[model samples]
Each structure stands twice: as structure tokens, then as C-alpha cells.
Target chain A: MASNSDQQSMDVNYIARLARMNLDALEARQFQTQMDGIVDYVRQLSELDVEGVEPTAHAAPIQNVFREDLAQPGLTQEQALANAPAQSGGQFIVPKIVE
Target chain B: MSAARYEAVIGLEVHVQLKTRSKMFCGCATSFGAEPNTNVCPVCLGYPGTMPVMNREAIRLTVLSGLMLGCRINPRSKFDRKSYFYPDMPKNYQITQYDQPLCLGGGVEIEGASGLATVPLTRIHLEEDVAKNMHFATCSGVDFNRAGSPLMEIVSEPAMHTPEQAVAYLQGLKQTLMYAGVSDCNLEEGNMRCDVNVSLRPVGATALGTKAELKNLNSFKSVLLALRAEIGRQEQLLREGGRVVQETRRWDVEAGATFLMRTKEDAHDYRYFPEPDLMPVVLSEQQIAEWARGLPETPRQRRARFASEYSLPEYDARVLAADKAVGDYFEAAARGSKAPKIVSNWVMTEMLRRLGETGQEIAAVQITPAALAELVELTEAGAINSNTARELFGELFANGGSPRALVEARGLAQVSDSGALQALVDQAIRENAKSAEDFRGGKAVALKFLTGQVMRLSRGKANPQLAAQLLEERLKK
Candidate 1:
């Protein structure tokens, strides 16, 4: 379902706003070109001869992944906080979470 | 609207995090509420040159979910890599089940008129959860704590036709998972999240209409409200001869409405392929059956057993079995000391009220079922009057002491000694003469007030019924 070229740009910008992505002028112009390319690629995929081809959603060939329910030692606070950029009062601290 | 005027169709995808001790594909702990990213390792963090070793328990839990949901377990299933780029997704590709899922063609039974109605389950597959994304003004932060977590995604057929039916299906699914001990099913903690697919058609339409996907419904109540709002929006479009576009929407609980997010065409391509790092999983039927045998009694079966074995009312059985801890509490209390019905009363009324007031799940309760059973037994045996039992229950919850011990230590037990109660009743009659005369004249409430006075004289320990009888005999003379 392709829309008019001029109208599609407006819609895309609106969607970018809804997703809270602030695309600058240069990024918007680049995205317009990229969007057209992606639209063409998907259109080509739709044209492939597939009268009865089952759609594949996954690519991995693995099954039966699980773990036993047993008690195990967990990471200590010091070890857990080793990678943090900041820590305080035995808790990881970032900028205040909310106003 | 009348049933003949509209047709409603619904399908649900429920994501459940398995309650295993370790991650799905690694030995990293699966526990939640740890310091952020503490449990992560190279495998889970998607570090280069590291390969994932499939956890056997993750597979077992997936097959078990399929069995409990009434699905056909695929002896052979494969994991695929779903390609995506996001800050929370460090690898840019997630290991998941795609074409060949672990369980296919399964269904769960929901309560229907007369009995249980089996809802056809389309598929139950295994997947990995993404990391948490915290948005800032200029940038976004990522937490790898949830990344690589084991998730089972269950898809149901578009068979549910009403909001109530959708909620019931969700409840049933949660119950089955909890009963199998596969998950804790805590919605608030994001252990259970649901996405609903809803479509509307004409009253007699043979084929389904365009469907919209709604996401981020954190609670069961929100699911119902979101679906209802979507259904209403779709009906309005149809009645006005407008087209209903197939798209993904997000429910804003604060606004109480659904907002269009994006169309299907703009959706991510995913670029799914066989994960190069992991191997295909194969399970034996005997192996699956063993896991199935170990499953705890599912909520549906437990509800039926509670009704027939304990002779509990249908509503009581439903409420008691709503959660595993609540059901266990009822069973422990009813088994040895008090009758089932009496335990049900205190639990349904006082215990439930207190739990709700404190906003605590039965699992977090300090009062054990054994303690509650003793409390019920004390009240039923008249060892303590109803008021004293109520007071003692408050103390038991607050102090974490045994019900019997608290009653004994506080001297709150009923005074069954007839001589002691009658003397207090006599003292009460002598204290009030005109009110005693009025009791002889025919107002029965006056004697009730006098019984209260005698209870006060005994410091709230006198047997109320015996005190009332003694007061009536003395006033009649």
C-alpha cells in the first residue's frame, strides 16, 4: 500500500515524532531516500514466486533449552557494581530517575 | 449492540518469563531484582566469540507449557535469529523460535456456560527477552538485566469474541503457568505481558476483518479496557463505511484510549535466519511426558478438586484457587483442625481483607496457613468468641505470633465458666434498673446492651451468648 511521495514524507515525520526520535534536517533527508529504498526492497520480496511457501520467522536451529531449579551463588554487591559508572549507598546510582 | 449486528474476534500473545534458576541459554542466574546487569556474562551480553549453550530446563519448561496449554509438542524444534537494531538489544539479533516452534496446535480451556470451553491454541514458542530501555532527554540508557532472559510466547487462535472472554483466557493462561511452577506470573513485575489482536466483521461475515495489534497492556484490567476501546473504535469506522487499517497501536492507560503507532508495512523486517551460534533442540516424547507428570495440579483441576473434595462453593473455590499461595493456605488450614467452610469464611473475609489492605500477595504473608487454621479452630470450638478471634487475628498479622499463643497470652479467650459469666450478668442487671425493667416490658435490644455491659465487666472475655441468657433470666425475675 504505497502512498503519494509528498504525503509519505509528512507521515514519516509524524511517525518519527510519535517514536520520540528527533530527526534533524539532514537525517530526515537521508531517511527519505533510505525509506524509498526499503519500500522497493519489500516490494521485490512480495513479487517472489511463492504459491505455497511457508513463512519462516526464526533462523536458529535449537531446541530444548532449560536449566535445573537449584540454588546457586549470585553476584555480590561489589562484583555487581564493578562495571557501574557510579554507585552509592550499596545501590547503583544514575541521574535521578524522575523529577 | 445486539449480537446480530456485529462480530467480534480476538487473539492473544502472552509472554511469560520462566522461573528457572539460570538463564535460558547460559548458567547465569534467572533471578530478578538483583543489581542491574549483575547476573550477566559474556554469553548473555552477546559478547563476540561467545556461543550460547541451550539450557535444558528452558526446553523442558516450553514443552511443559505446551502440554499444559493443550498443544502438540514438536519433538523437533529449531531456534532462529531475529535481526533487529536497538540499544537494549546488544547483539542486534535475538535467538528465538520462528517456523518450527517447540509446541504447535495447542489450546487452553476457559470457563464457559455449563463447563469448560477449550480455546484452540495456535502455537507456543520460546524466545529471549530484550533489555530494559530507560529514555532520557538527549539519550537512552540500557539495562542488560532482562536481556537473554528465557521467555515463552504463547499465541491463541482468534476465537475469543468478547472482552470478558479475553480476560478469562488470560487468567486461565496465568493459572496454568503458575500451577506448573513454570513462572511466578506477576504482572506488576512484568513477568506476564499480553498483546491482543482484535478484528471486527459484519454480523454474518464468513471471513475475519482487518485486525489491529495493541501492546503495553501491563495489567488484566487494562487489557479489557484497551480491547473494549479498540473494539469501539473499529465499530465506529465500520458503521461509517470507513476502512479499518491493520496497524499496531499502544494503549495509554492514563488517557484511556488507543493511539496509532505504525502501519504493518513500516514494521521491521527482522531478517530471521538460523542462529549461527546455537544448535537445534530435539526432545523425546518420554522426556516430555516425565516433565508433564511432574506438573503440579493445574488451577482448573485444582478448582474442581477443591469443589468436590472440600465441598466448597463454586465462588469460594474460584477465589481460593486464584493464586497458588491462597490455595495452599486454605488447604493447610482446612486439613486437620477446623471445618472447610469455617476456614473459607475467615479467609475470604478477614484474611483477604487484610491482605488487600496491606497490598500483599499470599506468598508474602507472615502468617502461616497453620497459624490461620489454629485461629479458625479456636473460633469454631468456641475457645474464643468471634470478637476475640477478630482481635487476635489483627495481632497475629501484625506481630507474626501464633494465633493460639496470642489468644492465650492476651487472655482473650471466651470464659465458658457459667458461674463466672452469670455473676457478671447479675452485676450488670443490678447496675441498670430502669433499663432492666424495659427488658421485661418487651424491647429485646435493651438486653443486648446489658449483655455488652457484662462483656465489658469481664474485660471482653465472657461468653456472649451465655451472658445474654443469664441477663434475660435475671431480668425476667
Candidate 2:
């Protein structure tokens, strides 16, 4: 993000935490170098803006694609929980959720 | 530094579950209480290559609600992906509208204040609701039946100063949405949920204070209690030279206070970005107008109209128009009736009382408005005394039938004919000579006792007005 400096720094630990990953210091430092390169390229692209171009949300210029409100048959209980690592009483089970 | 000098500033974020037939993006049925994961599909479960398509009815219904609330429709709005990590949503993010929401700048009219006032709205956006998590001994089970159901969030500005005003705002929105047939708005059934932000500032201060967000206020009573407690807590802390922290709190109904849930998170943490999978939603004026057509008048408008049209008192109009079904029933029974005030009294007292005691819905009650009107007319015409009409009312209320047919079949009509009344008047004079003689002896109160005798002699069908007049005339001689 410090585009003016000759060398940029990236906080890989912060990014890894947001992505729900646990990494060692060595791996974090290595990933930080790779992330710095990615950010430098993005900083270069950010310098050339026309100031009048509209921001596009999607690549295709389409709108208002909708389906009717009729219900369609979805998966059965067996099919829905088929790939769960843990299951009980026909439901997918995870570790106890607390507030 | 006085506690009484501090005023509470409050705002609410309300979420209402739309009564749609299918999910917001996928075709899974949105039925509540279904078995766990039965409504799951790859599109809602966030599987690869599964994209979302909008549901037309959900969009139309949300727009209709916006129109009823007097919001401006945006011509172009797009979806944004709000990044978060939660087990309820499989994609680790939620598809919502951040900057470009669908409707903007509406107000809800609340009258529980000194007079009618409008609480200004920030915006209303449509999104998908998450799944339900039920905890067991060591695990939490996921039920995808509620996932991807259409949910509408209405955000209000920090315009409320008291808890009652916030509740009035919620009730106002509930009535309008229910009248529009967009939702049931049943709070106990989890159809409507609310979160409130509260802060306190000194009286006559222009600046705001740090706010705490309160959740799990399931009912209006709890909202009132929790807010009062939280306001007291903040005032005490401020008086003791302590600072209020910005945090999220959960209401404990049993404890009568709010406990800290978490320290507040910054908005930047969500990292919202435009959704790449969804195209921008562009609506035309023609489409907005078409959606607005045939929308019912809001509850506020209906309350005002009922006061003028039916010549009812403000109290009657307020109570009647609060519920859609009760308002419709009143209009049907009161239309073209000579005594609308009388009709209003009966509805507010007898009909509502019976409905409450019997625990029956107004729709399921066997009494038709036309039948009820006939009973009122019969009493007004003196064809049957009010006492006899009330007896017939009980039967008609329990079982549907014509009041006229029931009265005719039971021979319950009053003896208004002079010849038939003369016989009963003479029999009353013969049976109760003491009351007749006392009436003749200049005791005007004796005529009421004589009339009772005539009513008893006529088997409770004697018109009290005619009987009193006859007794007075006969005793004068």
C-alpha cells in the first residue's frame, strides 16, 4: 500500500487471520514477499484512471435476471448431509457454537 | 451531572422475513420447521459453479413495502459481498446491498408520541437470511431450511428519544407490511426481528454519545424494559465519572439488564465489495408504478380515514385501525348504519371481549357483519327489545344464521301492537295493584316496577318504552 517507497511491506499475518489460517513466522515472511509483489503490481495499475469511467460490478452488461417464485424440489436429507465430516440424527454437526 | 438531565438517543434496525414461496436465490421451499438441511441446494450451500438468480416476487414485494412507507425507488442498484466468517453462512460472506440499496428516504408515522410524528428512515435493502443452529451436548446442528430466504432490512435514523417511540415505529411498520400482504410480522414466530442502538447525551446538547447495540429483545415489553435498564446503567456510569464503551450487548430478560456480548467492530472489517456474480438491478419507472398499483392504504392513512368517514372518536379509530382484520370488519358492520357510534361501542366492548374470552379469531366467528347489522336495526326499530336482541346475538355469534329468521322462528319479537300490549298492561295492573295504586298516588317511580310486571307477564317480550307509557296513562285515571 506504500506506493511511494522503493520497497513495500505486506502484513501477511493480518491477511492470514482474516482468511482463517494459522501460519508460522517463516511461512508468513515468505508469503509477505509474494504479497508485496502482488500489491506493487496493483499500485501500478491504480495510477492510470480515466476519472470518468463507470465502475462495473460484472463483466457482462446484463440486468434483471430473475426466476419465478415457484418452489422446486431440492436435495433429500441424505443427499444434503452426504458430504459432512460429522453427522447425527440426519443433520450436519459441527463443534458447539457459543455466543 | 444530574441523571435526569440526560436524554437517550435510539435507533433501530428491523429485519422482516418475507412470506415468499421459495428462497431468495435458489428454488428450495422456504417453509419453516422443516427437517434439517432438507431445503439445501448447491446454490445456497455455496458449492462451486452454482450461481444465484433473483426471485421476482421477493423484489416486487419489497418494492411494494417501500412504496407503502413512502420511499424513493432507485433506478439502479447492485449487490455487494460483505465478508465475514460465520458457520451459519457457508460462503464466509453475505450478499447484501451496501451503498446502492434498493429504496431510500422513507418515514414511519407514529402517534403514540404527543402528536403524529414521522421517524425518518435511512434505507431498506433486500438480502438472504442465514441458517438456524441448534446446540447439543458437544455439537451444533445446522438446519438449512431457513437459509437463503428473502429478508428485508429497514434502517431508521437516530431519531427516537424514548423506548415507546421505538416500539411505535416497529408497530407502524408491522401494520403496513401485514396490510400489504408482504409478511405475517409475527414476532414470536421469528418472522420479525429487531436490533436497537442506544446512546445518551445531555439535555440540549447537539452532539451524540457513544452507543451500544442491544440484541435479543424478542418482544415489545422486553424492548421497553431493556432500554430503560440500559439507559439507567449509562447514566449511573456517567455520574460516577466512568466512560461509556462502544460495544454490543445482549438483553437478558430474566436478569432485567443487558450484558456485554462483544466489543464493537469497525465497519472496515467487513470489507464490502461489489458482488461479481450478480448483475446490477435496474428498474424502470413503469415497473415501479406497476408494483405500486393495488397497494392498500397504510395503517396511518386508514386510521385518519376511519375517524372522518365513520365519525368515530380518535381512540376508536386508533384501536380499530391497528389491526388489518379488525379494521375491515368494522367497515363492513358500520357502513350505512344509523348508529355508527353504537356499532363502535359494541365492537370495542362486546365483540372484542367475546373474541378475547373465546380465544377465537375474528374470521372464524360465525357472526357476519350483515347479520350483526340486522340485529342493531331490529333494536333501533323497536321490533325487539335490546335485551331480547342480546340473547339472539349469542346464538348468532356461535352459529351463523339470519337474525330475522332466528327472531321469527323463536317468536321473540316485541309486543308493540296496542291491542296485544293492552292485554298485558291490564294483567300487570291486576297482578300488582300496590305498584299501580302507588303510581296513581303521585309516585312516578312506581311506573318502572309496573313496567317490569308487564314485561314478566308478557314473557320478556314486552317493549319497556310502550309498557311504561301505558302504565302511566292507565294510572293517571
Candidate 3:
């Protein structure tokens, strides 16, 4: 599934910024080559002539899965904030955001 | 500067909370005004490894709304995750329809300045509501009670040109959703919220200008005012040789001005991906047809039918059919009465006035439709006069009672008996001999004066027509 050597290069730093993550220069360079290899491997599927095939969103053939509208009891205030790293006055506290 | 030289292009995105018992993906009560964070569950709280199950009722209601708005319900639809970083959204990504929406291409007919105009709709999609963020002085609080609630986003095309048309379009949409029983559409409770997009262009221009999105327009009035302020701001900028930047503005309701919130560059790139937990919704033609057939008559259809079936004027039908409760009350009363116009008059003038004064809903009125019908019938039968009916309506509105029973108990029955009214008439003629002589002398005003005296003597119970007849008969002698 290896791609030709002349394929377009991937920009890992740009993609990392979009995902709101920071990566050093060395890591970005290493991830760029690895991501290129993964993309090339996945691109091999384009060789097949499956023109009439339907695009599937899920792997399993399932539809119309739903739940009833009846309400059940949920978490209390204490339990809801149990996993919070910081808390104040029965609320989860985080860094202040000003806009 | 001539305001007429510029045309405003406007579109609206409305979010209506579906009236479901539970949240969209979990078994948590969707009731508003509950204690903060009480409705939070594992799935809604975005806890790791918790999967969401679609609420069937929410999907049904979304389809119901789509049908009411005349939208084409996509037979195959699926959900996608819209990624964003907002504190109110517990998941940091809202599960909504992106490329494939549930409904597409509908129009709402509004009474525009020129006449009836149809506001074209772009799409209607289903999404999960986020938690409410309440800002305070020192810190902000979050209420997860509204989190994960079912919300439908109805996006309109840039068809509205004026603030008035936008308001009309919103009102028409609200009426249709309410009639469909899919949502309460209460703005005060935050069940319905709007986002407006406004742009300006030269009059008769072919291309559209850059648009600024308006936020925090909770009420219809705010939507109108915000659009007006934004349009003015844009026009002023253009006239000053400055360009209008595409940004989001917040409407300062108190200051009556719009302030810049964020620019297009700051817009979040909602990296969307198909939701894997929930299965795709594949509806059959038979199912869609069945749902469409079972839908109630839309507000517009009801308005038209009210005009033709009840023989009411367009104005009367419009006002009556604007609200479902009012329309139902009018129909119930009209069905009982022979004269539908009489019923319309009572409802439009008297009933609506009382409703406004007491701040009562039509369904909560003390006077039932049957009672009102009975009152109208009594007035038409000459059992009670118009003045007496008005008084009775006031009493009935204050305290519930049957019009017939009240009339009988209060002794308000009109005195149509010639014997009783003739006695009263003879006494009035004797007491007002000068006026009787004046009447015989061909002064028509004197006859009215004599009848006033007879009515006063009879305690207003005298049948006016019979009293006039008896007075003329006595005058001839």
C-alpha cells in the first residue's frame, strides 16, 4: 500500500494547531512522516472500481435504534462534581474565561 | 443619508426545545427551572465510555415539525459530532446533523407589508441543547438541567428584507410549531432562541454584502430591534467608506445597540464526524405518509378554513387562528351558535379584552365556550338585551356561571309582555305629558326622551322594541 515518492507531504503542525494541541518541531516532523505512511496505506482502497456501492456510515447493518421517552433519576450535585479537579460552591471551577 | 437607498438581507436560525419528557440521549428529566446539575447523567455528563441512545420521541417531534413547516423529511438521516470548546456543552462536541439534515426546503407564509409572503427555509435539523451558563459578578454557574435536551434548529433563507418581515416570519413559525404540539416555544423560559444574520446592499443590487450574525435575541422584539440596529450600523459603516466585517454581534437590550462579539477568524472549525453510537434513522415512505396524514391542521390552513367554514372576515379569522387555544374556543362557541359572526365579535372584542386585562390564557377563562354561546343565543332570542348581555359577560368572566341561570337568578329577563310594559309606558306618558305633547307636535327627539323615561322606570328590563311600540300606541290615544 506504499504511495509514490512524489505524493504531497502532510503538515502535522497545522493539523495539531487545529486540534488545539502543541507539538515540538522534532515530534511534528516524526508525526508528519508517520501520518503520510498511514494516509498512503488507506489510499490503496481507491484502486477498486466500486462505483455503484453505497456509502455506509456504520459497519453493522442496523437502523432505527432508539429509547423510550420516560425519564429516570440522574446524578445528584455531589456525584456530578465528584470527578472535578476543582470545585467551589457546589460547582466545578475552572480557569476564568473573559470575552 | 437616504435609508431607502440600501436594502437589508436577513435570515434567522431558531432553536426550539422539543417538549419531551426526557433528555435527547439519556434518561434525565428535561424539566426547566430545576435545581442546578440535578438532571446530569453519565452519558450527558460526557463521562468516558458512556454511549448515547437516541430518544424516539424527539425524532418523531422533529419530523412532525418538519411536516408542519412543509419541509421534505429526508428518508435517510444520521447524526454527527460538531466539535467546539464551550463550558456549557459538557461533551465539548455537540451531536447534531451536519451534511445530512433531517428536513430540507420549507416555507412559512407571513403577512408582509405588500401582502402574504413566504419565507423560504433552508433546513431543519435536530441537535442536543447545551447547559445554561449564568454569569455572575465573581464567578459563573452552570445549570445542566437543560443539557442534553432535544433542540431543533430551523434555518431560514435570506428572504426577509425588513425587520417587520423577520418578526412576522418568526411569529408564523412559532404558531406552526405550537399547533404541531412539538414545542412550547416559550422565549421567557428559554425554550426558543434566535440568531439573526443581517447584511446590507445597495438598493436593487444583484450581489449580497457581508452579513453580521446577531446573538442573544431571546424575544421577537429583540430580534427586530437587533436587526434594525445592526442594519443601521452596517449602512453607516458602508457610507463612511469603511467595510462591514463579517462577525457575530451581541444585542445590548438595555443600551439598544449591538456590540461586536467575535469575528469570522475566531469562528470555531467544528470538525464534524459521523456519530457512531446511534444508528442511522431510515424512515420508510409509508411511515412518513402515515405521520403526515395524522398531523393536525396547520395554523395557516386553520386560518383559511376559519374564513370559509365560519364565514368570518380575513381579519377575524387571522386573529382567532393565531393561537391554538383561542381558535379552539372560537370553534367550540361558533359550532353552538347559528350566527358565527356574532360569536367572532364577542370573542374578538369582549373575550380578548378580558383576557388581556386579567393576564389569563384563553383556556383558563372562567367563561366557558358553552357559556359564551348560551349568552349569544340569549341575546339573539330577545331574552336579554345587548347591554344586559355585556354585564352578564363581565360577571361570567369574573366568576364562572351559566348565562341562562344567571339571567334567571338576577331577574334580567327582558319584559316583552305588552301588559306589563304598557302599564310602565302609560305612567311614563302621564309623567312626561309635556314630552308627549311635543312628540304629537312632530318632534321626533321627544319620542326618544319618553322612551328613556319608560326604560328608567322599568329598571332597564323593558324590551326596548316593545316599550317603543306601547309608547306609540298610548301616544295615539
Best candidate, TM-score? 3
Runs off by more than 4 Å, candidate 3 = A1-17, A22-50, A86-91, A95-97, B1-4, B423-457, B471-477
Candidate 2, residue A18: CA error in Å? Answer: 2.6
lDDT of each: 0.80, 0.86, 0.89
- Candidates 1 and 3 compared: the better one by DockQ is 3
Model 1 stretches with alpha carbons more than 4 Å out: A1-99, B1-4, B34-38, B47-49, B111-116, B204-206, B308-311, B427-459, B471-477
Ranking by TM-score: 3, 2, 1
Estimate how well candidate 2 is docked, as a DockQ score: 0.56
- What candidate 2 gets wrong by more than 4 Å, as runs, is A1-10, B265-268, B304-316, B334-342, B357-359, B391-402, B405-411, B418-460
Comparing 1 with 2 on DockQ, the higher-scoring candidate is: 2
- Candidate 2: docking tier: medium
Candidate 1 lDDT for residue B145: 69
Clashing pairs in 3: none
TM-scores (chain A) of the candidates? 0.57, 0.81, 0.83
RMSD versus native structure for model 3: 3.6
What C-alpha lDDT does candidate 2 achieve relative to the native structure? 0.86
- Considering DockQ, where higher is better, how would the candidates rank from best to worst? 2, 3, 1
Over the true interface residues, superposed, what is the Cα RMSD of model 1? 6.6
Q: Native-vs-model 1 lDDT?
A: 0.80
lDDT of 2 at A22: 96
